[model samples]
Structures are given as C-alpha cells and as structure tokens.
Target: MLPLLVVSALAAVQSLAYEQTLGFNSAPIVETRSLDEIYHAALAEGGVVTFWLGGDEKGDEDAIKKEFEGKFPGMTLNLTTDLSKYHNGRFDEQLAAGHVYVDSIAFQTVHDFPRWEEQGALLHYAPVGFDKIYPPMRDVRAAYYGILTVGWAGKWNTDKLPGIAAPIEWEDWLRPEFKDKLVLTYPNDDDAVLYAFDLIMQQYGKSWFERLLKQNPRWVRGTRTPDTVMQASNSSWAASFTSDGLFPTSNINVSHPVQGSFVTWFQLAAIPKDAPHPEGAKLLHNFMLTKEWQATRGSWPVRSDVEPPTGYPAIFEMPGTNITYFREWMSDRAKLERLRTWFEDKLGSAQGLSPLIDGI
Candidate 1:
C-alpha cells in the first residue's frame, strides 16, 4: 500500500471531484455563460441531451430535432413528448431505480416540481436571461422556472353567434338567453379548470356555481373539447377554453374575460439532478430562454424582453389576469379530492380522461 498521507490526500481529491461532478456547492451558480461556451462544453461531454416535453407526441420530434441540430451541429437532441402525468410517473420510477436518463424536463404538471425540488431531484442552475424572467414565473430559489404562459378564457364561434357578443365576465355565461347554449370543461377533469371554477366561486360567491348550474351549461371532460365545440358551432360559447392564439378556425374568437382571466399554471422547466449531460441540458435551457426560441411558441413567453405575437397583449399588460399558483393547490390534496367529489356529485361523472390526470 502507498503511504497513509498520500492515500488520504488522493481520497480527498476523489471526493471533491465527485461533488463537483454532481454540481454540489455551497451556493449553486446561476449560469450566466454564453451559449457558445455551453455548446463547446456540451460537445466535449458526448453532446447528447434528452427532453421530456408535456402533451401528445405530435410532430415536435422533427421540428425540435431539426432546430436543435441546426443550431448546434455536433450535438444530439433526443426529444420525447408525453402527457405530464405519465412522465411524472416515469420520472419517479427512474429516480427510485437510480437510473435517470432525461437531461431536462418541460411540462405542464406544475404541482409535482416543488416535491421534486424538496427531494433534491432537481439541479439548481438558473440559465442565462434568468434575471429577465417575470418575477412571479420563476422560483426564488431558482430550482425551476416558468417558460410559457397559457390562459383559460371564454371563446365563441363568431359566425354561429353573429348576433351574440363574446362573454366578458364569468357571470355573462349565466344570461337566461344563453341557457343550455354554453359549454365548459368539467372542473373535476382538470386542475386548471378546477382552479378557474374556484376563482369564479371566490369572486362571485358560492352560489355562483349553483346559479350557473341552473343555466344547464354543458360540461365536457377535456379543455380542447370546448374549443372544438365552439369551432364547429355546436355550442354558442365555451366558458373555460385555453386560448393559445392558434385556433384552426378564424370564425372562433377567443377573448380574455373582462372581469379577470385565470393564467393557468405556467408550463415549467427544470433540470434533473442526475442528468447525463448537464452542459447539454444547460445549453438547451439557455436556448429556450432566448427571444428567438420563445417567439416560435403559441403561448406567451415568460421572459419580459420577448414581445408577444402580434394581436396578443404582453403577459403583464393583460388586464385582471390571475396567475394560479399550483404549489398551494398541490399541497392540499384533501381539498382537491373533496372538490373533485363535490363536482362529480353535482355535474355528473366526467366523460373522458383529463389530459392533466390520464396523460391522454
């Protein structure tokens, strides 16, 4: 064996190297480095990155693969899109098995992230442009940040309801003339829809839902159904449609509620602690924050420097917009369950799988 002091010194060096590899530090550094620096570092470390995106596996594979590959010639981008709920379960399994494969995650399941942070499953690295992000959209601790803003608002088929005006308030749907003509996503089917109902109840009182129920408004299971119904002119109005500013039909007009609209949980992004390619993940995270990347998305970017697409107002400029803090709701599981039970009792069973719950 080598001398004791020499052996001890070597062991200490090895421990320090291990900690550095794991990104362990007294204060996690906020990544302010340039994209080029991160890119070269990523290339030096095998140049492979994986992202778990929320929602269906629509043609994002080709687009993201093309964009990232074009941007970083030598880097390899592995992109997978699945319902956030399914990804969450998959990630939990990965963590339990100590076999993490994903480098970064961008998803709509805002509730589970806080838990992940608490467990130290997340790497705390604020990407470049971190300071430019909207204050409410980023975590104070810099564990995770909101990259996009999606709103739940009222919409209608203008061609079908030429004589009728879009609803400017929650109570506008309760108009006697609109009875049985309004459609909304079932509150129990989605957390965002449930939060919207809670907001309406809080602002208008408990009897607000009771009165709206009296109108015989149809309740569907998915958020997309309301928008689809409105597009097809099957419903006069949809009460809780997500406005992405990319509707397939021009006849369907979406408007934020005059009284206020709910900014459903922001689509959140974070790096897992055991990511295989931290530099690649960091490079991708920084790239996402760029105005160039944000401008391509239908949802509003969380970065203040990025201008929203023409016709849509900037997030801060929107009047009476309530940002829903999903962390609070997730903490109160009992209340969520109770509310779900109550809604089912009143509105009947939800017809289909909630994209939030069933990952459909």
Candidate 2:
C-alpha cells in the first residue's frame, strides 16, 4: 500500500509538470489605465510585486519607475533593491520553501534560469507582444525575457594598452606583458564572465591558462568591479569581459579582438510561478519591455522598433556569437566548489598564471 501511494504521488507531480511546461504559453500585451486609477488600484492591490535590481541596473530604477507610472496606471511595482549577499543561495531556499519575496527578478543567467527552472520557480507566462521577442530572448517555460540588452567584448583603455589595436586578437589571457595586468571577474559569480571564458577557450584553445598567467590580474567580486577599476585607471586592464553598450568614459572603446566574433549576452527579467498577483505582474512585465521605457533608460532595448538613445553603440554592429549552455564550463554543482577552492588556493596568487593552453 505504501509503495502504491508513493507511485501515485510521483505520477501526480509529473502530471503538473507537463501541464505547466506544455501549457498555453503566449505573450499577451498588457492593458493600460489612467494614472489616478493605476496608483489607487496598486495601492489596494491584493498581493505584493517585488523586483531585483543588480548593481549595474541600480542606475536605471528612476526611468523604470517613471515608465511604469506612465504606462500601467494602476499597477504597483513596489520598486526595491536587494543586494542580499546570498542571491543564488537564498533563491534556492525561497524557491524550495515556496516563499516568493521576489515576484519578479532582473538578473544575470549564470544560474538564475536553469537553477530556478529546475526548482519550478519560473512561472510559464507569455506577456502580450511576446511574438516580438527574439528566439533567444524568450524562455518557453520561464515566463521572462531579457529586456536590458548588451553585447560582450574585450574593452580596454587605449591610452594604457598603447600600440594595441582597437580589439586585439586575443585567444587567451596569459601574454607575458599582460600577465598580472589582466582585469577579470570570476564567471562562477557572473555567468557572462563564465560565458566569455568558455567562448574564448572554445574558439581558441582549452589550455588557455598560459594567457591568464602573463596578464597577472586582480580579482573583483563582481564583473562591474573589474570594469570600474579599468575605468578609474587603478590598473591597466589589457582585456576583460564587459558590456560594450556602457563605458566608464569616451576614453574606453569596445573592440572585437577577433574581427568577426563578438559574443553578446543578455540580462533577463522574469515573473515567478504561483505569483499572488499574476495579472499585475503581467502588466508590469509588458510595461517594462516597451520601447519608451527602454529608450528613456539610455540602455539598449531588445525591440527592433526602438532606436538606441543618442551616443549609444549599436549592439548588432559588432559580430554576435550566441552563448550556448556549457555544463563543464559552468563547473556544474560540484565543479563550482572545486573552482572556489582552486581560486582561493592556487589561482589566487598574484604571480602571473601560466596559460594552460595544451591538454586542457
């Protein structure tokens, strides 16, 4: 009898997964209302709507708030910032316990999507105008798409790395002169950084540790940290994985080291499954994706109809390489811990890291 019950429970769980995964997932356009109506409705709304703004996006909140206020009059955004040290860790607990402090999140891909999706944290939702989203942008089951668009490339201070071309054809980070000078963010923390290394090694060579050793570099907690350091002139960062759409100043130029292979990664926005206020969430989601909001933020918008703001570098102008899933490069669940140990012990040394170019 106990065995039969266990089998029955497993079948029930499988049934639910099928319903959600293959469910009616389509993007629906969110309706709008008057400012007064919108504000009152949101204030009296039944559930809370929470969003996460990472360090890079903290600057865009004002535009986000203004745009929401203008578009979906009654929708309440509950605008907030959460830099909780344990972002990925806490998400695990919350999703497992089913505590949805985060109604929606705007974060990187490193483990946000795959990890959360595995836990059934993502709600299968498609907002209005979903058809407009590019294939890579839409997640058939996650109910979120990348709204803030940016391209990836090796950026540097031309004044510092003199004699180097706009984009040096760099296959690894361990050139002798570049050793210890390479400014990099750990990909384990930021998937974009992870993807950058994977792309470099995959296209160039696996034993690329030689490149890292030559350019002895410092480690920053966040990808932006290294980029900011490069901008402030703290160190001469010969090459780094960063968003080309943004620069510390005009002095920073984004270049394709390899003429035709620039890899671009998108930061995503998503709604939670089992949301208390799904309708309100939908309204907010669509409002954020609109051209007006994206243009006002001075960031690249995913929509083709929207032209980039003044002085904005076109993401498409650079040759784009798509980032595919890499379990080995991800270091997976076990490898990540192994990497953390390796980083703190072996790679942490200030000495130039020899590029592990062969037999990797």
Candidate 3:
C-alpha cells in the first residue's frame, strides 16, 4: 500500500486535473479573441449554430435569428423557443439518443444547468464579457452565466385605483381598502411567484398571507393574465406581474417592492459539450454579451458596464432585491412539492396555465 501522504497528494492532483479540464476558472477555455476572429473561425467550421431558448413565442426566436444574421453576415442562426420544462425534456431525449442537436441553450431551468455541468454535457466557454459579468450571476465553475435578470413586482392600474397611492412594499398590498380589487397569480403556478411568496412569508409571517386571502382577491393562472387584467381595468392591482418596463402609455404601472423583490430567475446560457458547431456557439455567445445586443434585448444585462434601460436600476442597485441562489429549493423535490401542496390548500387549486412561456 502507498503511504497515506502520497495517496492524499495523488487524490488532490486528480481533483485539480478534473477541474482544470472543465475550465472552472473564469478564464474561458476558448482563447481570448475578438468577435471578428471568432466569427471567421466559425465560418471555417460550417457557420451554423442552433439555440433552444425558454419561451413559447416565435417572435423572440425570429428576432434573435434576424439580428444575429444581420450582425454577422453569411452565418445562420436557428433558434427554437419553448417552455424551459419542454426544452429540458428535449435535451434529455437528445442526450439519451446520443445525438445532441443544439449548439447552445438559454433557459429559466437554472437548477438543471448544474446537473448538466456535472454530467459533462455543458461546455465551459466564457464569452468575451464573462469577466465583466456580476460575480453572483456567473457560475463559480464557469460552466454557465446568467445572461439576463427578470423581475416580478407589484403592478397597479392608475385608472382603476384613481386617487389611492400605489403600494411601495409587499405589506402595503395587505391594506384593507385594496382588498377584493387585487388579482394574484397562484403562488404554486410559477417558481418566480413561488419565490416571491416565500420571501413574503419569510418577511411578514404566514398570518399575512392568511389575512390577504380573507380579502377574497381574484387568483389567476399565468403571469400575463394579471397584467392583462390590470391593463383592461378589470383589476385595480396585481401582486405578481412581470415588469417589462414597456407599458409607458398604458395605465398599468409597476412598483418595485421596497422590502426587496425576488428575482424570478436569471436566464442562464451555456454551450453544450457535444455541440456540432462550437466555434459558432462561441461566436454567438460573445456577440450576445456585447453592449449593443444586451441593451436591445430589454432584460437586465449581467455585464457591469451595460446600463439598464431608462427608469430601471441595475440588479445590484435594486433595494431589498433577494437574488439568493435557489439551487437548494430546486434540488429538494419533496420539500418543493410539499410547499406547493401547502399553498394550494390555502390559496386553492392553480388554474392549469401552460408552462410553454417563461415556465411561470
């Protein structure tokens, strides 16, 4: 048998070698090169890339294809938009068949990314702006990076509420006058909404939600439904509406929670280990991180240098923003199911909203 010290040293070296192979450090596996250089290399390697993005809307996919093709002439981008649940399932099938088709993936299924990384299904190729990304937003192992920050906050219609001051905090929504006039997405429907509810319970206690339930607020299914109801003046307020910051003319106004809001989930992007077009994936990854692309995407960019759109603060600057890592909650399947069941008992059954969009 080997000496104990020698055995320990060998084990350490093996672990270090494994991590180095995965490119766990921020330094990208691909050499530091300009987009133009990467593009040329991609052209040499069949100039075609495919991505699976989380969303049901074809418009976003078309927009990305158009923009990418326009920016880098002669290259082709094929993107598929579907619910993250469906996308993840498809990826599993592809992996099982030993024929992975997608070059890159962007999804709200943040929990699965780590699993894929561990399985060696993901490629650790940091884009050009990886170093500039928020430290919290990037993976410690450099396997993936959060490309966007999407938030859920309180939304109220000015026309419907008239003279009442808008809610500045989650507690304000519990006020007696706002009762019955509020609409909320079922807490068990979306992870983001669930996270928001969890934060509210943590800060205000279970009694707060019980009292709010007593108000008989209308409960809806999808995140979009609450926004739709508010915009049509059907509801005075919504507890968890996606604040896209595009509704300037509409009476619907979003209020950032003063006690901090839950970041629904960041859209994490990564290249697959078996990607048929890695050079193209690298090119696309670096391109998406550029200020021009990130600014136009309308979501909160992860790069520190990229400024958020007008009227929106950077993720770090947002007060009381709870950007806690949610891997624990995601990994604990039994606990998550129990939590969902508990909420359903209190809040009633969730309307079966299609998870095809945003996995909400």
Candidate 4:
C-alpha cells in the first residue's frame, strides 16, 4: 500500500482530472464572449488596465499600447516595461502587502509563472485561442500560457564580413579572423543568455568557455546591444547568441548552428487573481491572442493556427529547437545561481546602466 500522504495526493490529482472532464475546471476553456463583448464588459467595469511587460527596452510596449488602445477606444492601457527580474520582485512585494496594482504580466522568466500559480496569485482564465495554442505552451489548468516565442541565434553583419558564410556552427566565431570583432552579452546579466551559454558549455565543456573568453569579445550589458553595435558596423558578429527578425533588406543575418545547441522560450503571460480591473484584464488578454495582434507580432505566436512571418518556419517545426530546456533550467534555482555566480566571478560584474534606461 502507498503511504497515506502519497495516496491522498494521488486522489487529489484524480479528482482534478475528473473535474476537468466534467467541465467543472473549464471556465476559461468554455468562455464564449467575443472580443467586442469583452471590451464592452471592460468598459462597464471601469475602462482601465495596467500591464507589466518584462524586457530590456522601455519602448518595447509602444506598438502593443498603440494597437490595443486603437482597437478599443475609450480604454486606457497603462503598460510598463522593465526587466523581468525586477518585475517579479516588485510583484512579490505587492502580493505580500495585499496591494496588487498591475492587472497582468508577460515575462521572459518562465519559472516565475508556476510560482505565482502555486501561490494563487494568478487568474486561471484562458484566452480565446487557448485550445489553438501548442500543447506544451499552455497550462492544463488554464493558469497561464505562452504569448509568443523569443529565440537567440548567431547574428552577423553582411557588409562588414563580406564573403564569410553565415556562422551556423558554434566554433565558427572562435576563428582567428573573428578575434576582437565579436559583441557578447554577459550571461550573468540575463538568464536566457545564460541558458544559451549553458547549452554551449554542456556540448563543448568549460575549456570552450575559456577559449571564448580568450577571443576577447567586446562585452555588452543587454542582448539588444550586440545587434545595435553590429548595425553600425562596430562589430562583425554577435558572440554566440542574439535575437532579431527576418527581413530581406536587413544587413544582419540570424542563424543557428546546424549541429549544436541553441535557446528559445515562450514569453508567458497571466492575469493577477486580485487585478483591479479584472474585466479589462480579460479583454486585453483575449485581444492579444486574436488574429489581428498575433499576425503583427515580430516573434512567432504561441497559436498553432497562426502562420509564422515570411522567411521563418514555426518554432516547433524548426529542427534543433526545444522550448522546455530553458524552462527546466530556470526552475532549478540552486544550479542556476551557482553557474551564474561562477560566470560573474570570472567576468567580474556586468557594467553600465540597463539598456532600457540608458537608451543604448
């Protein structure tokens, strides 16, 4: 016989499954309100919604704010953009003080969502296209779901490095010709960037890390800084990982190694259980998943029904890509902190103001 506690836990799991089958745990799944209906409902409940977005750019939410407000006039969308690490800490403070101010959040810190759900801080509501979302991208209980996917790959300037083939192998950047011409984001500064470095280390060992440091890459604080530098012809290539959209005219080209590891993860979103404007929050959440918004997103949408932008395949369809690795790595706080500290010890500390604040 199983231990009493173990038996009870099994029973609880069975009960939840039974409830889900009976539609008792499916409010969000069964939602029938149209976006217009939700918008009207939001207006009825005070037409304001405050959202917190996790990013290294303050202007990241500008397009979102413009589209959201344009689609639903008379509604105010107060969106704040900042680093996910800072947002999560401030959110915890608000929850502890019982004064939750923000209505919703979309962040890169994938591990924080589960913690919030466990604390009953999240609203267990699904957006309109929840079922259309990829299986691994959403919570079964509808607590939260991935909004979009962000990826880091090798990016280089075509103008600066004229005849060089796209650097699709991890070892390509370490070549003698590339020395002192690489722009790198400090892995200690961003967990996603750290995960990318972790993948490379796992494949090639610590000696690879030492060799990378020997290349004497110009270190920057934010991942976006590399792209900025490369655009100005200040750097020939980004270190190992970087993010950008596909475009025909762009001089910078993004590529992933054909035979080594890379990193990508969904930027997850959820509403607060104690949101001041619950109706408005629901409206915004559903609005984000609609075809209108998803089509315009630079990153791939979580919905399987939505087509990826031209020149890029759906993330799941892409080879050598797995979203779960980064999430799992982030959840292991002990291991993550140890590796982060080790990197900091070797690189000293990240320097300069946040890219968002400094406008770098």
Number of the predicted model whose TM-score against the real structure is largest: 4
Give model 3 RMSD, 1 decimal: 7.4
Ranking by TM-score: 4, 3, 1, 2
State the lDDT of candidate 2 residue by residue for 181-258, as single tens digits: 567765444445545655565566646644565456665555445556676665566456544444345566564554
Model 1, which residues run further than 4 Å from truth? 1-26, 43-47, 56-66, 73-76, 233-249, 308-314, 324-327, 353-360
- Estimate the TM-score for candidate 3: 0.81
C-alpha TM-scores of all predictions: 0.79, 0.68, 0.81, 0.89
For candidate 3, write residues 133-191 as lDDT tens digits.
88877886578998766666667777766667777777787777677778777778666
Model 1 scores a TM of 0.79
Where model 3 places Cα greater than 4 Å from the true spot, the runs are 1-28, 56-62, 233-249, 311-313, 327-331, 353-360
By TM-score, the better pick of 2 and 4 is 4
Between candidates 3 and 4, which one is better according to lDDT? 4
Candidate 4: minimum summed lDDT over ten consecutive residues — where? 13-22
lDDT of each model, Cα atoms only? 0.72, 0.55, 0.72, 0.79
Q: Is candidate 2 or candidate 3 better by lDDT?
A: 3
Q: Looking at model 4, how many pairs of residues clash?
A: 0
All candidates: CA RMSD in angstroms?
7.4, 7.5, 7.4, 6.9
